[model samples]
Target: MKLKRTMAILMAGVTCAGALAGCGGSGSKDTGSAASNSGGLTELTFVMASRDEFMSSIEEAMVAEAEPLGYKIVSQDAQNDSSKQIQYIETAVNGGAEAVICLPVDADGTQSLIDAVGEKNLVFVNRPPTNYSELAADNVTYVGSNEDTSGYYQGEYLANYFKQKGQKEVKYLMIQGTLGQVSTTKRSEGVIKALKDNGINPVEASAPVVADYDRPTAQEMIQPLLTSGKEFDCIIANNDAMALGAIEACKDAGVEINFPIVGIDCTADGAKAVQDGDMAMTVFQNPVGQGKGAVIAADNMINGKKLGTGMEELGALDTSGKDYSDSIFWIPFEPVTKDNVADYM
Candidate 1:
């Protein structure tokens, strides 16, 4: 496959410089061959949607895992542009990459990416496409925790807290991530479903604010709500960053945080907040596990190994009892509270 890709590029008179020039403003860091490195080292291109605290951790883990296995990783930042992501994948494929690991900018718009990589192994990380059925090829797979599970954990924690308090109904302020992403929608829906399943009536204290998974944006958006004299029993953020932002907003407004505040992605800050008695709980979405799993999946595919091969290190794979288990690798999410925050830290 590598030889054929190389010959195709050469015969088409396509140089690395020309391909990269077409990538236009997309930030990239190449640690392997520029465009012509077809040496003994296998090349894998990692195209990220954007860089954030959790995403950076995943990227670092991928780099660490790849180095010891003699795989060269070319990391690129798509800056949340679908077109840029497609360009990066094309450039990587034309540059003789054995596999393309991408965190799609727009999960719903991944058909273009699948078409771009053609026969090369493509591993979609962190965010899976909206349509799971679209990933029909054996060469394509998804590696990430179930977003619904993460939110379910959050809702379960909150439900237990309220139930122990003997409260039947709770009003919550929700800080959502990017509006259209599968993570945002599923996380939001899952939390609601869990709350209902737990026999808790949930009410929206205020209209949910979209923060785009940004901390400062979450803080700014929630500040007015804090001072608006509205009654909310708790705050629920799609991710830890936004949860921390809500905490900041509460502090800035001199509001006492007597209610539970929960979030997903037991990030360092979120765990610290849980320990400090600020955040009631958080769900741990293992970035390191996801990253390593993605790299291993790519290596397995390239070597003609079955999917999920060598992924036992990530614990038992959650096949969801589906026939397509081979194409989806699920990393479990753990609920982190004061009792178990130390374990995650």
Candidate 2:
């Protein structure tokens, strides 16, 4: 009982404890990575990617998974700004955080932030980094799903759905997430590539996408496309939010697109939409699994725990791809069709 509790507390983010008390001596780049703050619970910091519903799921899961182990998790919302995210790291370092978990707003721009951790402890979620070396660095781990897998699943589903129905071509309106975000880029790439791989040449009905993974924004963005009189076989959104928005747009325009509209992040609403036949399907990007996996990895690393064989079964992503390593943990993604959507809801 005591052992389990200690493990939990160690990954706790920020609290009223002795975080500012002692251990003021900074070591490697990850200065406080393995140290305890004076007279307080271990301090950990979580830098949120944004405050959207999807991001909220990550935070809620982190708290649910980490708090019971006896840690107070402090969250810093970057509000889609990379500069502000760096500021959050400075705050964590000065506040004496033992470890920092971040869902980066800018994956390519996180090198400075990674440097800022100074070896204290760094775990990155959501965005998959282009720099593979960072994940293998000492005191650094990348905890996220395979960047292209979710998109691949979405594209694969569409291709198979149409192929099974004996359809030849697919005309899709791509409602993307944040334009430059790794999630957006990879998800879009995965879908496009997967479609091509499956012998499906997808046609884009809408050009100059309306980005930013917001429902209203997506709804608004699709309005122009609806009025353009272009035929669309389906909609592909980087997230469920945009997909839901597209649905709303169609309803308001009285445009019925009776096709398989696919999305990622089988969010609660997305799953419900599938049940009601509002959308065809979505992929389950496990926020709960990613959140808890981060805490567990941090706990084990701090205690000098080596990852054992068959660790790949944990199911976010397997360790066989480019990002595969002991330091990098991949969370697997699952496709949620109507036949299995109820299991998610």
Candidate 3:
């Protein structure tokens, strides 16, 4: 398992509201055991960071994959609430869930969750905690693609596209996700770095707007910017929902600027946006891989088996690190430009 990368390429895209795909339904807040099938399947609970399409996909994939592997999976929506997530964790702890796959509301805010998980295995999905490599433990590990890669890819593509057209100092409006989330921070840094490193002077069009990874919010937040006459040649949104929002906003204002917009997730809407030429590109962050991978890791953990042993085909499960306390597994991100958008869809 290796993360072989050219340090030379990829950065930013943001949040998810993926296709209406994947298995499983929204789980009850109740903590109770589902009767075991032919064998005593390990009971698992997934406490989601929020209730959205991407989270739903993760829950669905986990349930689908876990059932055959002699595991029962249930999920809870934290709705971006740390307190609610903690209460659910308390329920999971009391209900005797063999493992908990949590997507916390805040990446850095896990002290309460740590206290609640007790001896149960806590597998974080998608979002990594702040200073993760330093803070992660044997019981608390993360499974996700590198958030920076999406953004970096966006920046790299934009850099190359603009540079090729003999363009310089491309001004961009960055639509950010929730500020404190790990995805937001790393994606922001990574894309900006990619632009600078690629010999492109990416000027900020205006103050970055926080859309909270929602379309309406992005649309509302951007109206004022358009009215202010602040011009931007590109828009790098954290997620496709926001990127699409920017497009609609531009259309509504009847702005002559057909800004090149990029986003993350490569959701159905995002891909269509690319195909229809409403947006430029997006990076594919696979929920199925992440969901199945989490279930596989939990199965190994509960059985007292090695975590990375069976996960070779998914991605290199990086269980090794200097003074490592956790078994982390990383899924890689891929860029989806017009050149390759159809393959992803």
lDDT of each: 0.79, 0.72, 0.73
Stretches of candidate 3 above 4 Å error?
1-41, 133-136, 316-326
Q: Write the per-residue lDDT of candidate 3 for residues 67-169, one digit (tens) a residue.
A: 8887877678887789999999889777766568888887778767877887666777788777554223445656777775778999899999899888878
lDDT for 331 (candidate 1): 72
Each candidate structure's TM-score, on Cα atoms with residue i matched to residue i, is 0.88, 0.85, 0.85
Each candidate: how many clashes? Answer: 0, 19, 11
Worst 10 residues of 2 by lDDT: 4-13
TM-score, structure 3 vs. true: 0.85
Instruction: Report the C-alpha lDDT of model 2 over 192-277, residue by residue, as the tens digit.
Output: 88888998988887674755888999999888888888988888999999999989998999987687778899888999999999
Residue 170 C-alpha lDDT in model 2: 81
Q: Clashes in model 1: which pairs?
A: none
Superposed on all Cα atoms, model 2 deviates from the true structure by an RMSD in Å of 8.0
lDDT of 1 at 110: 87
